[model samples]
Target: MPVHNSDIAEAFRRLADLLEIEGGNQYRVRAYRNAAATVEGLPHDAARMIEQGADLSELPGIGEDLAGKIETLIETGELPLLEEVEGRVPEGLAEITHVSGIGPKRAWKLYEELGIETIEALRKAAEAGEIRDIEGFGEKTEQNIIDALGRFEGGEKRLRLMDAEHIAEPLLDYVREIDGVKQAIIAGSYRRQKETVGDLDILVTAKRGSDVMDRFVKYDEVDEVVSKGETRSTVVLQSGFHVDLRVVAEVSYGAALFYFTGSKAHNIVVRKRAIDRGWKLNEYGLFEDNERIAGKTEEEVYEKLDLPFIPPLLRENRGEIEAAENGELPDLVQLDDIRGDLHCHTKWSDGKFTLREMAEAAKDKGYAFLGITDHSKSQTVAGGLSEDGLAKQIDEIDELNEELDGIRLLKGSEVDILENGKLDFSDNILAQLDYVICAIHGGFNLSREKQTERVLRAMDNKHFNILAHATGRLINERAPYEIDLDRIMTEAEDRGCFLELNAHPNRLDIDDARCKMARDMGLMVPIGTDAHSINGLETMRFGVAQAGRGWLEAKDVLNTRAPDELLKLMRR
Candidate 1:
């Protein structure tokens, strides 16, 4: 058996919990949390070392007393300390201690009184209104548990991208501050800039990895420790999302990160390239003759393999490696190149800003124009406008256009494509608008074929200038309804309608892959930050970056055109 430090660390972890129950120093109790992290991130097995005659005291977080306890376990095959505590306190009580509204003292009280040991029991008590009558838990507290129980019962524990950032950003900086940590980068979907993230994956390089993971598990934000092992540690944040930290040596930092933070397919292509050139690839690096060579940074990894550094989004294995090897990778888009937003809503619909305020904010960002695409009448829930409402809004747009010198206000509507694929408004109404981005707001359950046909019909609509949020994926939660993207792209190419890359994080439609496919068909894409508020406009940066991953150039995007040119293209 690889002497599992996690098994040993967990034993000590129980004592640490008991210490909290006995009202021990908060910092002393924190030592066990710290030890858990240290054990988790050590690249080499400390338990094996302890078995091989290395003292546990040599480990950074394991103190003399903790070391003695580890020694005792190695000799006697049992931890008297943890077993004694287990005798007094019920087994698995620490596990129950993580319920959101329940603290350590309350958890101990439950064990001493009601003998609650699992989420099910707690839910039953709370739902039966037994918890509200507990000393510290009030009606509000009881209600909070009831709600959290619904979440707990559902077996869903992922964090939203926004929530993950709230925690990961600070810890990322803190890990960098540690003296031994040479490099750290966020891997996984967060790095891909997905609108929704389940958990955060962080990769770090350190001379003191054992010390680092120990410090990491106590990340001030971590509410519960999940597992700790050498070179890896997993923890649950107060928000109930798990974050996995992997520690590698400084020398292999880049290669390890590139491998671990993966879309999987991207790594396969890169490794195939190495094999073609008589090299083997792994987290450490490309190796030949048992001698490590190639890659100290992500850029170096690509350069050594003779290719461009692929961005996280492009790493989805969409022929980028082959294209790069041939020196034919399309010029990817960049954040700075974006100069305008075309799909935005205003208070006229469900947007938070007025038309002028949204436009002026665009101007401040140095954009040349703003397209006000408020929801059309079919979207009643969003206060979608009728013909007269649109006309009134257009008048305000005209007035705003006059107030600005160079910037133009586009009179546009995100008209609903009724189930049959027709625009919400009549042709006369559509003709009066500068552009129409017809979208699907309902009929989410349509079969893939019907959905494709529905969108195809809208794409061929003479007045429809863009097929907005094609597939309509809400990232992490909603699977985009199946659309024969081939048919939609084919129809889009036949007509001159631009494909909308809705830049709202929740809807970065035409995602990275579809954008490449569309560009391959010579269809122009318009990367629109479907900005509904000033802050929403910031998503344009990711939209642009996502396009870059697909090797998109400015010419490939319809929004890159000047107002007159864009108007002409939309009219086409």
Candidate 2:
């Protein structure tokens, strides 16, 4: 059982949750949480780093004490501290905290008052009308618990796209190394870049006697082999993630890849087109009567159908086929098209790096500019800066810019939108920065009408340049707060304010569907990483993938502009 970075991160996260539910020291709980984020964000495997004698303590937020624990876990495949905490705390209580509207404190309170320690027990209590009798809980809270439980169960069954990548990339590399293997790729929803994936579909082209399937099942992570055949196999990984692999001949490789990498709806429409043209299409090839006509490549198949190649990201049957026919397909935004990032944090707020370090990282990425949008005074938990603190940061940024070269830093603040629709900072304070990214950190339970109006009123301010994570959703963890996005987008367009496609994997807010809506309305969407550390900056690629799925071109993004042009656009 090899320990991957994700494994270490998950262990740390679980330990933190259990400790918090058991009333551990606040700083101790925070250390584990921060360590989890650091390990998870690393581009390379932590276990390998330890093998190479690298000092984990050198990583941001990972102290000498924490580094020792990581090495111990890597060497022994277990963390004694985590085991110790688990022995004292009901492990199920950690899982209960994951439910929407429930935190560690609330979970602990439930356990104390109702003797509920697991989701099932909590559900039973809620259904029996026992939860409302608790001091802080009432009928609405109890009902919300039942609704959130449904979502929690469904979300637990799927893996986030980022997590899937962590598992698939290593496996794909292992498969490609097998004797006689030719080409290998993980298809299905993973290839389409969906926010979540149910399972992985891998396609390969190999020589006649390739031992691909035989070796695939023996990979280091395989926990169970469900089935095995000459050219196909199924296995479940140690992480409980399922994977399927299929091998095909050279001629059918493209067709197999196309068939496996699909939105079912998109595949159905394409198959219909083939049927109407007196041709048959399947995993093997496209056949006309008894002769094969296309399928050596996806482009070849599309060409035979009188259409151009549709990128996998756009193969959702969402006007893509018609667009290809009318020659109106967009040149989707690529990672290279971005000139800068307009939403990031530094140590002034809940970030891991200093301004100079973050700027150097941006310069390394070839970015022309980087925006420093620290939290406003309202986000105290995140060490939000007061008005004077923000003023000092503005000065520090000016000083750093004068000394730095190639990367210009844009001073900005991620101000909070209050429950009554007022910006956290007044106009006097906001006008001092290069831009403002207003967001909602609390009040997620507001009515849809109020939520929409709260955002609409915030946009009325001249300083509101962008709405951060427009929906306040945390993917599987929390559903988006109720709001009429159609009305909000229209209001933003009228006000000349942009909406963010937050690139954080946990909150790919303003998801693909909304991205398309903004595109249709001719609104520019900035792909902000909402990065908290230098490693966090790498999430820009995910945003680009989402943007491509939404049919956006380089011109449809705000940060694609050069520094001067971007500054001009920022001014209302």
Candidate 3:
């Protein structure tokens, strides 16, 4: 097995978890966690670098000792130190930490008080009313544990799209480098640019007697080969993602791609249409009485069915086929249509780069403008700015605007909407900026009506221009708190404020369904990266992909307009 960067990262993370549970040195545990983060976020394969005999210590956050451990894991697929730590700590206790609201300390406490080292044990304890008797746990905490356990049993967790890309792209490149490969693509939800994917479907056209399957199973990241055949194979990557590869003839490549790249609902509707036309559609080709009609290209497949071609992103069975039949399909938003970013951070708060650096990075990306919307005083953990601090930064931005050319900076703040629905800063202070991005950072446990009302009252403020991360969801980590989105959308439309499609991978909060709803309500949506670093700006592409999935066009996105037009809309 090839130890990819993620594998090494996971090992380090597990080591840190075990060490923390064992009550080891706090700083040492933190070092391992930070090293894991840095390794996981690397743009290239660290394992490949090790293969080439590169020095791992040069990588960020990886010291000499950590580098040696990484090399050992890559070389042996095992870390003796991690194994020893596992010996001391109950491995199931680590699993307990995965439950929402159960941190390392909490897991340790559970093990100490109840001998509950596994999820099943914890659930059993909670259900039997044994957990409520423990210190710091009551009826509500016990119920929360039970609820989280139920959610865990509901389904296998899915990977974020970007993480899937990290695994798939390198594997695709390796496949294309094979001796007889001709064409290749990663199909399924990845092709549709879905927010998360269950697995990857890879399709390839190869020459006769090609060794693509052999090559695929032999890849370094293949932790397990579930099945392998001449034309099709399924393998589990080291990162726990399953991949299915199919080697199809060139003649049937198009049909195979279409068949595999589906929202099952979309595929069902398309197949029904073909059947109504006296044609059979499957992975091989579109057929009439065993004679192939069309299969070489997706365009031809759609043409044979007398329907316009549909972009993969729009194939969600959400009236897209009907719209295509009537020639009413939207001109979906593309990556190039965005003109600027309306919400990003800088060194002024929690961002990684300085203001000038962020501006230069945005300018390099051909953006006409960028907004510096750091957190307000409430997010002190993120170094949120005080009123006086914001005043000075506003002046600094004005100075940068005069010095800079080709790009403009908008002074703004990601102001917190307090529990009672007041902006973090006063109206007079907020009015000094070009715009504001109001958000909820705390009090996620409020009731649906109160949460909705809190947001409604905040949006009622004149300075509340955009609602950031409307639901405050963190994909696999946290569920969106209870809130009625319909009333919020209605309020946003009537108030002239916009909603943000936050582009961060963890929080694509205003999901596709909500984006369509906002569009239908005739509200402008801004695709903000909520970026904190230079590389973070590139997350805009992910945002655009999400917008495309939502059936949005350039006209529906606020930041697609030129700076003057965007400012004019803001002033409205």
Which tens-of-lDDT digit does each residue in 1-572 have in candidate 1? 12244445556677777777656787778777656544533333455577578776766556798788777765565888777867877665565554444657887776666768777787888888887777877887788666645433223535434445545676799888876887788898788765557787889877753388788887766788899887889998755667888887767777887887787888888898899989998989878869888657778888888888777766777777777878777766777677688988888986767887888888888888888999999898678999999988988888878888767789999999888988898888788889998888777556689988888877667898898888876543355665788888877777877788877655678877777877778888888877656666766876786677666898888888788888987787
Q: If candidate 3 were superposed on the true structure by all CA atoms, what would the RMSD be? A: 3.0
The TM-score, computed over Cα atoms with residue i paired to residue i, of candidate 1 is 0.68
Higher-ranked by lDDT: 2 or 3: 2
Our model 2 lands, by Cα RMSD against the true structure, at 1.7
> What TM-score fits each model?
0.68, 0.96, 0.90
lDDT of 3 by residue, 130-202 (tens): 9888889888988878776765522357887766777788899999999899999999999998888889899
In model 3, which runs have C-alpha deviations exceeding 4 angstroms? Answer: 3-104, 143-155
Per TM-score, what order, best first? 2, 3, 1
Ranking by lDDT: 2, 3, 1
RMSD of each: 16.1, 1.7, 3.0
Using lDDT as the measure, name the better of candidate 1 and candidate 3. 3
Worst 10 residues of 3 by lDDT: 148-157
Worst 10 residues of 1 by lDDT: 151-160
Tell how far residue 188 is off in model 1, in angstroms: 3.0
Off by over 4 Å in 1: 1-163, 194-196, 207-211, 227-232, 276-278
